[model samples]
Target: SAVISQKPSRDICQRGTSLTIQCQVDSQVTMMFWYRQQPGQSLTLIATANQGSEATYESGFVIDKFPISRPNLTFSTLTVSNMSPEDSSIYLCSVLFSGGGFFGPGTRLTVL
Candidate 1:
């Protein structure tokens, strides 16, 4: 299992602004994923980031809006760009390890 941590647990930003969320894992992982959870909704896979490669985003999400970077096995970042009020949600990073998935505490964002 890997211990995960996220920075700026929560933030309030104005519309059209952007925010970058950081994820740190305790151990090396082959693949890392980013997810978004809207209010009262389940977690939705945003993108899959692998070291040394471009991130693969899920349907309804694009690289221009949600960019991801996996610099190494243990570190990754997801940025929400040109955020709007509808973008307010909790963003999380996760990794599959030893047949199980571990996720960070989550970065809560509220776009005004």
Candidate 2:
């Protein structure tokens, strides 16, 4: 399996601001996705980063609020836009590599 890493391991942002998280995979992978786990809640899929195409967002998530960019096979970014206190959560990137699934160290965001 490939090792995944995320930048800005954690952050504290003010409401109405935005933050972008970078996800890097040690090796090329075909599938990449973003997820968020709110306090005391399970992980929720935000979107699927598709190479050469727009990301596919899951229900309750809109591209305008959670934009994603996949420039290549091994790198992608997810931006939380116009954040609010309710948006504060732990964000994660996941990839399927070598028949195994791996998750990047999450980025914890706190919106004031």
Candidate 3:
């Protein structure tokens, strides 16, 4: 099992600003995934970060808007670019563990 930590439990920011969230893992992992969950909405995969290679982003997400960095096997970062009120959601870092999944506490973002 791997333990994950995310920065900024919650934050409120103005529109047109950006926030970079950091994710740390206790142990090395093969694949790290990012997700977004809006209020009353299901969780959606944002991207998959593989060590030693570029991150694979899901549809509707672009490198310019959601840049990802995975420098090693146990850490990653995601930057939310050009924030807007509609971007308000719970951003999470997830990892597969023991054939299941685990998530961070989540960074609740509210762009005003």
Q: Which candidate is the best by lDDT?
A: 1
Q: What digit string (tens of lDDT, one per residue) describes model 1 on residues 9-110? A: 999999999999999999988899999999999999999999999999899999999999899989999999999999999999999976789899999999
| Global Cα RMSD, each model | 0.7, 1.0, 0.9
- TM-score for all predictions? 0.97, 0.96, 0.96
lDDT-based ranking, best first? 1, 2, 3
Q: Which lDDT tens digits does candidate 3 get at residues 10-100?
A: 8999999999988999999989999999988999999999999989989998889999999989899999999999999999999998778
Stretches of candidate 3 off by over 4 Å are none
TM-score of 1: 0.97
Q: Is candidate 1 or candidate 3 better by TM-score?
A: 1
In order of listing, the candidates' clash counts read 0, 0, 0
RMSD of 2: 1.0
